[model samples]
Target: MASSTKPPPVEALKPITSVSASPPRLLPTALSLPPKWLNMYSSFITANQSSVTQIESALRSLTYIIPGRFRDAELASESLHSSIQLLSMYHDTLLTRAISKLPGMPNASLHNRYTKFWIAKSKFYRRIATMLTMIQYTELLWEMMAKRKGERVRWRIIVILELVKAVCRLCLLRITNSRPLVTPALPERETIPEEEAPTEEEEVEMEEEVTPRVKEYKMKRTGLSLPTLPNPSDISSYLLSKVLTADDIKAPNTLLNKVNGSAQLAEILHIIQPVIYAIAMSRSKDKKDWQPWLLGLSIEYAARQLRKDGLRTTALEREQWGKRGWAMGWWAMRGAFYENVTKGFLQSTSERLPSLVSGVLDDYKYLWDEYYFSTSSN
Candidate 1:
């Protein structure tokens, strides 16, 4: 019989690995987690955002329903609105980190690459602008409260806030090199946080998905390495190359060839108009002086026209413009215009209406007269 040597023991049959063999590639095991407390807070706030919004809306509507006789209720509603806004601002601070972690386009086209590069470059200023806006809005609420408190320093505070905002916009303009400022500065991220950490199986799936590409990338450079043209689809290499370095990404160029000088000017004027109004108010003896109204309205009208002429107004800009237009109706309440024009019109209209409708109109009129800041554009 052939000496059938039993197959080598299973352990001995195993192939020997070289001592210098490359270490196993480490794969990311899980998605990054924010601080536990922050995760919980953000998760709670984000999950209830819609409910909060609904509650706010209810509060606002309550102000309309509550008669002027209930002054405390009206003030309470206003306070709650301001409190909710402060909470929203706090949420915004946490949002920035989430936004930073978002993945970039790995296979961006030339135009996309340029856009991404500038956006990344301007990220800091954009964040500053966002913070300033939050402060401005929050301060406005406090300023209204301060006015009620008979604080002599409120005017100075308003002037300083407006000036600071103007300066921030100027810096933004300089950074963009006169490019149209993106309103809101940052895009909205998901309000809802992740409900659960990824499961082990999901993590393994993600590892499997990512590992092959990494291995392929290594395999491509394994042998006969040579200087080859950078792939246009490879965003990392493109970013590292001289192309982005040589070009001025922030140069005054139309975004998608749609923006124009008119848009830029409109944005600038829109930003500074509040400052102009604040200055006029500070100098004037009468808070509702026609001079300030004329000055503010003129600047605003010019901005609106320039924006219209640009033919490149975003939906958001258009919406804001519409809001400004509505706010202009409030101008009738300012200066002698309300005493001479609007007051008579309202009186006549209310006289003709039924008692119930007239009562509602009177409540609204009370809101208009008693709480000027409620409808103020600034």
Candidate 2:
């Protein structure tokens, strides 16, 4: 009996508790992939990469279409103009159609698709540069003819004026539409009303008293966030005015000696205001954020248009100036919104967090150098 009893006390398999084999080690869930369309679009941008060469070709091809070019006589002025008008219309229509069809709040895939479509469309309209050049040229011709009453023909001038208007519209549309959606910000405006009347003694007293109070209030309330979608109509109006009225497009450095004394200030202001608005809108939470990327794009585009003579500064200088303008704009925006731009830049690109603060400061410094030194030197 004693021998038969405790047969090695059979190690009581204590209910095998600790998840027998660690609960079947779960394999990681695969990340959800972007749709196929998006992959295709990204591949397209990579394949048909934009470069200085494409930009140069775009500008040169368009220059060929200019009305008064040295070798443009193969076609009649009317014929060339018609050809340009048709090409412009076609490209404009294509862009408009593509934009209208784009889905809102598109995922990364959709963004890639849109980008690819735009790049491809841009290639198709390598002729646009010519159209814009011609438009600018036509406007100049019309203005010159206006000054020379002896050279003006009423009917022909009417036709040319219409063409100019048409071209200007196209230019405005292209610029405004080409811009990816920007975030919206508050327009500059006066919140307080001025009194219609005040006594001389009271005015002096009010100036001393009310001015400080108002200034303090303004300083306190100076900053604000912007909206996402600005009215495209508003941007169009601003762009149209600049394209038609820029003195460089009308005549050259003659305005350098004029009333304001800044040769391109008006044009700069015109371009800057909308660009600022675009940046604000790009920072908006509701839409796809594009301000930072758009800033980079705008700077690159400006660089493409610039060239150097024997001057110490080159087109790179101009591009650098554009970036400086962007940095200044962001600095102003921080003040305008009553929020810190550095903080905003940090928050915007937070996923790339480690270098965020220093990066913005570096950008600010680089831009300042470009604006104050390079642009002035050029």
Give the best candidate by TM-score: 1
Which candidate tops lDDT? 1
Each candidate structure's TM-score, on Cα atoms with residue i matched to residue i, is 0.55, 0.19
lDDT scores for all predictions? 0.61, 0.37
- Taking the tens digit of each residue's C-alpha lDDT, what string does model 1 give over 284-305? 8764457887898789788877
Clashes of 2: 11
Candidate 2 lDDT by residue in tens digits, 190-223 = 1122235877998788777743321222233656
Q: Give the TM-score of candidate 1.
A: 0.55
